[model samples]
Target chain A: MRPTVHDIAAAAGVSLATVDRVLNRRPGVRHVTREKVENAIREIGYVRDVAAANLAKGRTYPLVFILPASDNSFMHGLNDEVRAAIARSSVERTAIRTLEVPAFDPAALVKVLNELGEERPAGIALVATDAPEVRDVVDRLVKDGIPVVTLVSDLTGSQRHHYAGVDNIAAGRTAARLLGRFLGGAKGEIAVLAGSMLVRDHRERLEGFAAVIAAEFPSLSILPVIEGRDDPEMAHMLVADALSKKGDIIGVYSLGAGNRGLIRALKEKAVDRSLTVVAHELTTHTRAALLDGTIDAILNQDAGHEVRSAIRVLKAKADGLAVIEAQERIRLDIFLKDNLP
Target chain B: MRPTVHDIAAAAGVSLATVDRVLNRRPGVRHVTREKVENAIREIGYVRDVAAANLAKGRTYPLVFILPASDNSFMHGLNDEVRAAIARSSVERTAIRTLEVPAFDPAALVKVLNELGEERPAGIALVATDAPEVRDVVDRLVKDGIPVVTLVSDLTGSQRHHYAGVDNIAAGRTAARLLGRFLGGAKGEIAVLAGSMLVRDHRERLEGFAAVIAAEFPSLSILPVIEGRDDPEMAHMLVADALSKKGDIIGVYSLGAGNRGLIRALKEKAVDRSLTVVAHELTTHTRAALLDGTIDAILNQDAGHEVRSAIRVLKAKADGLAVIEAQERIRLDIFLKDNLP
Candidate 1:
């Protein structure tokens, strides 16, 4: 027979009630007593059967997801996936709640983090605003014995346990390489469209794109990025204006969301011109654009995978269990018109 | 206030013991009695918590993996992933066994399937041979109440519950587009390499590749396929001879294994040739070749993902539960030098 709570209690020289409290993580157990019980359980090689334990104790993992209040297809898709997870809350024993804050506002994110410290949830997952203040709060939360994971946009130089997103730099580098190679010795300028450089993912993408373009494709020159703030109207206007002004531009790389406007601009301004385009995200607009020859390639991160990975990592951390690292890796999905899924 | 087995028993007008037999799948209950209990479960919307039930009964799902005895990097990687799953058998509550048979031998596969009827494993996952005999055996297993999943390669016109692999046709179509566009307006013949035309995946890839190239890329023409038998010596010899003879061949597509041999052939014969190559699978040899410009792009299926997905689907089927459809999709990973991982 497997080792039981009774065995743990015996080994720890503690009462069954104390063992029960420690096992269920209930209050009123002294710190020394808890450690003693934990040590005994470890020494006895007791495998805590989570499914049975959850049923017996009604153990629930209270997980919080902090997202940006950005109106984009990607963000909407992410919210949908979180809602789906919420629907499975009963079966999975997870109580998930979402909090949205102003995009790129470090102070707002920090305020939410501070509030979460008081709530003491089992785990917290967030799209971090890459700022020192946000990092400080995240580090503080880790120090306070909370499991923290960064979602789509990661927090740099922080004590976060895991990042449930792709390598933004590699995504950017891939975009640059695809665009550069597709152009194939064509001497021309390239236009870059981005939501904003303030966010770490966007910045990292730009950095990688620029680095690869400079080192490998010296014939193709990169023009200044058109920051449309990920708004369709703003992106359309800026892209159309840029395309009209830059007649020598042969390629376009949309490194961030809001591709609806970019597609509209490409069709209107670059229809007669022989221009190659690469983009991010696989929204309906981008998918159609790719099929119609407006975009050559798309580099995407699956929002569903990110959300699921975040929840899995958070749950594993909560349970003090190691996750399958390879399984949790959010692979960058590169889609061409032929391989769109 | 969730519905319990006792509630089900009361609703079904059966004894608690009868309800327990139906729930645990014990062989004592009559067919009509089982149906009544099942109908009661459905009517009351009683959710079966697998974790709790597994703990109560120590239920172990007996899953068998059938693989081809091919000595290649991809097959080796897949075997490693299966071994990894076997290592986690205790935590996952799985009793996994693997059977290897000759590659592309449908008769051998059918023999194994016929023998498995007596053993009656909870689930079976197999790399299908795509023969009528294999399909018939798979259908028989499904009819016999065994949950069946096709891994890596799928069996067509069969009753397999799921296919834990990529869409090979899409992969081939994407490869053709990538190769076609990368070559620009250059008029040349393309060399097609394959392990054999017997497997469904290889045949589908060629079909998609041919259709796309014929429909879109008018300037490029395909040469006769060189069967390498997934052997390094055979692939190297055939590829080297083809490159030597077909000076007009500007691009190459390796739709199957033996990429190591292809890489060696490229280095030995086409060292200075500006040949555009697209290949399947991303092993160490292929990754290095991609970085060195020997292979321009790599199309891959995550073996780990497929293995885990098969296990999850099997477990869910055994427990009469539903799987998250989107979560179980095995995506095709497209790797360029810039985004190797």
Candidate 2:
């Protein structure tokens, strides 16, 4: 049987109140009496239950999630996950609130960060833009003893305590391999689609994808990149324009959202020939495209998993507890039509 | 501020002790006074803080995990995850004990189920063998008011409260798609390696793989399945023999945890040619093989996630609380060399 405070009290020949004082590290216990209680506690193997103790002390964590207000399915899904977290906040003993700023606006993000720094929340999680001002603000938060976690698009050079997202570079390289293997020695040009070069995730993915394609599939040439800004209409226009110009394009690799536009363009232009397509983010549109073979495969980072992981990390950081890294590591999920869920 | 027990006592015109008695459902409180206190509680919207109450009551759930005693890497990883859970039991307010029965022995599994049912632990999580007797035992446990969760392998036609694993059929279909796409229009024989047909997961995966191959890739033919029983030596021998017999084998799909043997066999025989290999479970061996270009892709259901999900589901079931189905759903993860965690 595990030893309790009462057991320590009995072993030390002291009162239960004195033992409680010693256990809680409260004042009003003499050195000799404290030493006796400590010795008794040491004699018996007793591990204090941290969760129970926190509950008994009525502890609650106040956390903030800063997200980019983007009109993309993936960002909407991420926001939905955060709202789900809020719904579960009472049970988890956390007061979670979300702050949304304009997407891709580093100055707006920095301004919000400065405002949050004044209040000093227990922790902050944000989808960061890799700008000097944003990095400075993140470092300031860490310096002020507020744990910051970069969610989704990470600001790697910043002092963010953790990143709750997949490695974009690896995801891109995987996409390249899948596209290359699926095409199988077919000599044709491959077109690349991305949200913007400003976001670190997009740029990193492009770098990885280009490197793999150049190293492994030298037969297949890559066309110039099209920056879609993750806007469906803009992506569709850009892709349609590319397809109209390049008659020999046989493959398309989309390393961002705006798959709706990509799908529309494929439906319109690639009707003559079946093109091998690999896309990122499994939204309703992407799922349907995958089902109908318009898109061959999808590389996904689950927004729900990312939000939940961020919350867990923030809670652990607040308590100075070690997280189970294996459990917390976000996997880059590759999806085909067969394994949709 | 939220209404506290003090406010309930004041509103109900009862002493603090009487309120405590009513709240705790202790004896000696009159029916009229109990109704009054309950009415006061309802009037003030005073939802009981369950975590604090559990702390005061010193409640700890004793959970039992029944696993297969197999030397396979997946089983070892599962056991290690359970041990990690046990290490974290105190903080999570759970006492986790593991019971190992010999692999593929339904009688031994049934015996352990009977013993666990007799003691009636708060919850039971098991990698179930889909036999009538095992299903009956699981139903009996549920009828006896015990929560039962089927882990890695599920017993479908049973009253298990939850299944904390991926859909095996989907996983198999995924493998078929990957192999079919990677081997792109190549007319050659594809070999299948399974643990056993008696296990429902293997059977389901075989069914899915066959269905997809028959419908989509009629060019590629599937050979008779070789049951390796998830033993490394047996798998290696079977695979080597198959490779020796079939001169035009271009692909291999392993839907079980015998990749070590399969890898050895492939290295010994098929060293000159690159075969499209799709395997299940990502252990250290599989990860290394993937990085070194031995294994092309892996379909993995994370053991750590499964163990943690089972515990969460069990605790929720024990408390008769609703679970967030989306949060609890285990994902089927697809990993290539580049996207490996």
Candidate 3:
């Protein structure tokens, strides 16, 4: 039989109240008595049921998820996943609330971070707008004993407890490799579309893509990056303009979330020639594009996985517990039409 | 503050013992008293702390993981994942044990299943050896009210409660797509290697691969399958023989384990010409091979994810609770050298 609080009390020859005091780290217990209880706990091998203990003590984690107010399928999916967590908040003894900041607005994000630090939620998980001020505020929050985790877009130099996302650089390299190999020695230019250069994920992805193409596929040339701001119409316009200018463009790599625009442009230029395309995220648009043979492949990070991973990391951090690193590492998922789930 | 057992006791005007009896579903509780206690529980909106409640009731799920005693990287990895679960068993309120049966021995597997059914574990998760007798045993166990989940390789047409693995048919189709795209109009024979035709996963994968190749890439002729029985040495011999006989083999799709043998044969060939190879699972050998350009792509279902998902499903089934279907859907992961992790 497993040991319990009563077992520890009996083993230490102390009153149940004194045992509870020591277990809960309550004040006013004598040092020797506390040590006795601790030793008894060790001897009896009492693995505390943390959830039950928290319930008995009437403790609930107040967590805040800060997401970007971006009208994209991926962002919408992330929000839905967060809401799913909220549905289970009562059972988990957590009070989770979401705060949306304007997309790509670093100053507004910094201001929000400062406010949250003052409010002092038990934990905070944010899709960060990477900036020095934002990093400073994150550091300050950590210094004040609140656990902070970066969501999809990570803050590289910040003192964040964990990152609940994929390795963007590797994702970019994978994209390049896919596009390069899919082209199969065809000599033509490749067009690149991204959300923004300001975001670390996009920048890192571009870096990786450029590095791999330079090292491996010297035959293919990458055109100037078109920033879509994750807006589909903007992406559509940029892609259409580029495609029209460079009629010999053999491939397209979209390392951002404005796939609707990219898809529209591709459909408009629906010629008999095969154009290799790779994009990020699996949304309704991307899925259809893949099915119709427009997009060759998609590199996705599951929004649900990211959101769930964030909650688990934040909870573990709040409780000073070690997380399963392998379980928490959000995979860079590559999808073909055949493997779409 | 949230309601506790004490709140329920007071609200129902009953003793703590009465409340405990009702909550734990213990015997000797009067119907009217039970109703009053349940009413109090509903009125207060008390979310039962299942972990704590189980602790109080001394409930621990005894689960068995039946794996194949195959000396292959994937099987070893699966066993390691099950061991990882066992490491957390104490804290998770589970008693997990593993039983290994000889690889590909359906009769032995059926015998083991019959014995386990008699032993009457709370739950069972097995890498099923597909056979009618095995299916019968699974049905018998389920009839005896024990929850069973098929892990890794599923037992189709069985009474297994859940399958914690990827869709192998889709995996196969994805492999064909990758190989077809990578080969890009090259007119040469493609080699197919599998673990065994007896297993459902292997059969399904072959079916999918064949269907996709026939429908899409008619230029590439498929050579007859070579069954390695997931043995590396056997796979090496068969691949070497096939390579010698078919010098014009342009691409190879290995839909099962024993990649070590396949890698050895490829290394021995040392051809200047490129052989576009696709395989299943990501092991050290496969990772190194991918980096060195021996393998083009890898289709994997995370063994860790499968084991964990199976445990969650088994536990939920045992408790007659609903599972989050989306969360439990194991993704068919595609890996390139750039995205090895």
Model 1 root mean square deviation, Cα atoms: 3.0
TM-score of model 1 vs. true structure? 0.94
| Two-chain complex of model 1, DockQ on C-alpha atoms against the true structure | 0.69
Q: Can you rank all candidates by TM-score, best first?
A: 1, 3, 2
lDDT of 1 by residue, A199-296 (tens): 89999999999999999999999999989899999999999999999899999999988899999999999889989999999999999888988999
Task: Give the C-alpha miss distance for residue B222 in model 3, angstroms.
Answer: 1.1
Candidate 3 docks at the CAPRI level of medium
Candidate 1 chain A: minimum summed lDDT over ten consecutive residues — where? A47-56
Interface RMSD of 3: 1.7
Q: Compute the lDDT of residue A124 as modeled in candidate 2.
A: 97
Q: What is each predicted model's overall lDDT from 0 to 1?
A: 0.93, 0.91, 0.90
Measured by DockQ, the strongest candidate is 1
Q: Considering every candidate listed, which one attains the maximal lDDT?
A: 1
DockQ of each: 0.69, 0.63, 0.67
For every model in order, the TM-score on chain A comes to 0.91, 0.89, 0.93
Q: List the residue pairs that clash in candidate 1.
A: none
**Candidate 3 residue B163 C-alpha distance from true site, Å:** 0.3
Model 1 sits at an interface RMSD, in angstroms, of 1.4
Model 1, range B176-228, lDDT digits (tens) per residue?
A: 99899889878999999999998889999999999999999999999998999
Off by over 4 Å in 3: A1-46, B1-48
